[model samples]
Target: MSGYEKTVLLTGATGFIGGRLLLRLLDQGIKVRCLVRSAKKFEAMFPGLDGVEVMEGDPARGSGLSEAMQGVEVAYYLIHSMGSARQKGRGFIEQDRKAAENFRIAGEKAGIERVIYLSGLGEHQKELSKHLSSRQEVGKILASGSIRTTELRAGVIIGSGGAGFEIIRYLVERLPLMIAPMWVNTRCQPIAVSNVMDYLLGCLTTPETAGRILEICGPEVLSYRELILCYANIRRLKRAILSVPVLTPKLSAYWVQLITPVPNGVVRPLIEGLKNEVVCRDNSIRELIPVELIPMKEAICTALTEVEKGPGGIPSRQSCFLHSLT
Candidate 1:
């Protein structure tokens, strides 16, 4: 039903954001080719979804990228090295750099037109966590490539099955009272997963957004403690957080691992990232691609509603009514 239809290559089709984006692209009747590590897994996930071609490959390994990117007009780079860095003992910074380089080289060789990347929202002036730093660095590497690139950065994405949101949900639901690190005082602008998908899909039609780093977030800005308390309120639970300066990042990560389903490696980097304030600096993207941004409470409600329906039952952006920015 939308006008912008072209051959697109999605790198992280199996990821949380990428999966949602893939559904929207299909809803718009766009032809998409996905580069995934396993075609069988992708097929199993989507079942009978038509009009999507899956190519087996790993961007981190630099395998099957060119073949997957052939004739692709727009390529969405949503791949990250967080899990590999944390679990496999690989340097996340180096892994991300290598992946971006591989993607850049492949895109240039294939003559791809545009690159859309989702990164973290953090101020460059302040010291950032390795996870956030690596995200920004990947965006830079992708932009430096031959193809035009549009980078969208967000903070604390709240959605069902999302690591950040799940971590928060687990912490609040499992613990009525918590001893948190000082970083709990750090401020962040959380965004809804559906709104993030809207921005990603809208970028395809809006040409001016190319070569720009757009910071997309929810309308409200709240501290980490406030976010947790808000979630507690929504669940009608009395939660109290005691923030202490003595708790180091490592100790906080260990605490998180014990309290939630999040792994130690994953929570360490994520906990470290909370040290810096990650609020939006430039909101110009609001004017460029205007979509109704969901508030934090509504976003949490949506995520919780999806969780009530099991993981497979979680709806995509295409199934829900989305406002058109074009």
Candidate 2:
């Protein structure tokens, strides 16, 4: 590689977004180093993976980060503790905090140029859920470092194998009728995985994106109920939902776990987030990156066939999503 060529460090390279981002960066012939806990597991998960260096380290534990940050021009902090903060207790929050602190220290010492972080989209002034609040906290910790940081705050990313997408798919496909929580009426801006990918890559090449917290989302803003109905329409499945005032977050999670394959632990935090109106307040990023924001209907249709099975260790129910409807 030329001396001027950029080398990137991708944390959380094995996740739904990070895995696909890895392939995209590789396709562009970029020099990439992925920080993984076990090289053996990484190799097994991404068989025949090439053109990228694998560094065995756990970001959560703040291990091997200094070496990973070496010679890296930019780094992607895609790491997030996805477990429920309230249900799982303080462990998840602490993990996220430690990782961010370590990463900031490492990147600054190593003279990294930019850090791109995918953070949850929720207004800080509002009473944010534990999940969204934790994400925002991570973003703050990263930005405090000397390195320029670009935080992309996104709401429900509609994609196959993604936890958010999987939940919607199960709720719409399995249940023809749902007496859902009042949060179902909450407004959110959902983006397609492709659009999210484009924006992330755009931030890498676009210098102006550095040190900016941009809200990246689809062109359309939709309510949770409309999003479900949109999925049902695409599948040609008959689904009905009644917005009920009775279901608490815990109860909603239990109901979801009962019908969907998603575990109660994962379901609770997500359900808690549903109460917040996560619609994008800022649209300035569109001018900066200029990506075509896919509509709700088109995004859902494309995601239905994006992946049947989970790749890079993220759980998926897409394989059985259609089967259960019949």
Q: Best lDDT goes to which candidate?
A: 1
Question: Which 10-residue window of candidate 1 scores lowest in summed lDDT?
Answer: 317-326
Q: Write the per-residue lDDT of candidate 2 for residues 1-326, one digit (tens) a residue.
A: 21326889998787888888888888777788999777886788799988899998876667899989888889998977765333245566787888899889888888988899999999878899988898889999999978899999999998887789989987887788999889999999999998999999888888899999999889888899998987776677788999879889888888888887766666778899999988899999989989777877777766766554344322233432443332
TM match of model 1 to true structure: 0.93
lDDT of each: 0.86, 0.83
Model 1 pairs whose backbones collide: none
Among all candidates shown, the one with the greatest TM-score? 1
Candidate 2 residue-wise lDDT at 152: 95
List residue ranges in candidate 1 displaced over 4 A.
Answer: 85-88, 311-326
Output the lDDT of residue 57, model 2.
80
TM-score, one value per model: 0.93, 0.90
Residue-by-residue lDDT tens digits, candidate 1, 84-148: 53326667778789889999998899999899999998889988889999999999899896789
**Candidate 2, residue 190: how far the Cα is off, in Å:** 0.6
